[model samples]
Target: MVSPERHAALQQAWARLLDGYRVTAAAAYPVFDLLASAYSAPDRHYHNLEHLAEMFRVAARLTAITDDPAPVQLAIWFHDAVYDPRAADNEERSAELAATLLGPLGVPRDALDRVGRLIRATAHLTDDRPPPDRDTMILLDADLAILGAAPERYARYAGAIRAEYAWVPEAEYRAGRAAVLKRFLARPRLFWTDLAHQEGDVPARANLTAELAGLRGGEPAA
Candidate 1:
């Protein structure tokens, strides 16, 4: 959950970023408001304010190492903006929303395009091209950092995710979740950054793998 203090901190962080950029408070507020409204669905579970805060925290740390921050921040805001579990093209929709919202903010056409591309990048577990610059890599890592969280946190996240799909039948939910878990398990690197790779990836994978195994009526592996 995002504490009031944390939410305030995120707003301050955004304010600071805005100060450094050519944009105005007017433009930034609408972007933030629109993103918040988009994620405020009544059925939302894991994709909510808390998730946004966590990504922003990671993005702050990553900003120090990246040349471009605007595109990265835009990506973070819109990556899960349209998180309908049953939708096959949520990423595309989310990216489209980001482009639509940011285009009128006087954002350079190239920067807006990069943000759209970064939003779409989150849909896949693997990317053939080298990560899209430093900022994109950071946004990508932040979005996926949940996979490497502590066991209990990962378990909670998994449960929340499953709850989001409560519309699905039990058997279908189990199968769908198992497939997603297996896909992550097959990945060579779940965390792309050295910091997250060292601290978060193993525990996240272990937690999910164990949970999936137990869900399948076997003993937990972790």
Candidate 2:
């Protein structure tokens, strides 16, 4: 459960994000409730309120750099709002949910479209194209900030993700996860924005390389 203080903070943040669209608080709480409930799903381990809060923390430092931060903030709130590890359309579903909920709150049609696109972009590794704009880059980088977490935190994040896919056999899970990490390593750049690369690239690469090595029963290179 989200702490009372944290919940209040989230509420304040929601109100501020909504204000950018001139959305009244009266019409926004229900949508906030929907997103909160989704993130609180029992199946969610890493994609819970903690992750949401972390994204906000990352956004707090990044909003100033984004071309338009409001939609980026909104996108962060809804990016993983419909996560289901077994589902291929999680991003699409999350974007759809955001569009449906925010439309009634008076978010402009163009802004809504942007929010939807931002949420969908969190399906990051699934696509090869780079982030299309500064706002998209900020949103994607904020969502991926976890990759550069300290070793202990990164290990926990990996463990949480493994737990989420516990139904898969260890060997299959390792193979699939290794493939995902390798794909990222093969990329010319793992992060789009200069801010993200400066803050996260080295640590993120180290984490991925270490995890991949562990998955393959080998030591990470010196």
Clashes of each: 0, 0
lDDT of 1 by residue, 106-193 (tens): 6678887888888888886454344756766788889878887777778788888878888887777777778888877877777776
lDDT of 1 at 30: 65
List, residue by residue over 88-167, the lDDT tens digit for candidate 2. Answer: 99999999988888887778889889889888889885445777788887887778898899999899889889888888
Least accurate stretch of 10 residues (summed lDDT) in model 1?
124-133
Question: Candidate 1 versus the native: TM-score?
Answer: 0.88
Off by over 4 Å in 2: 125-128, 218-222
* Model 1 misplaced stretches (Cα beyond 4 Å): 125-132, 218-222
Best by TM-score: 2
Each candidate's lDDT (Cα)? 0.76, 0.84
Model 2: lowest-lDDT 10 consecutive positions: 213-222
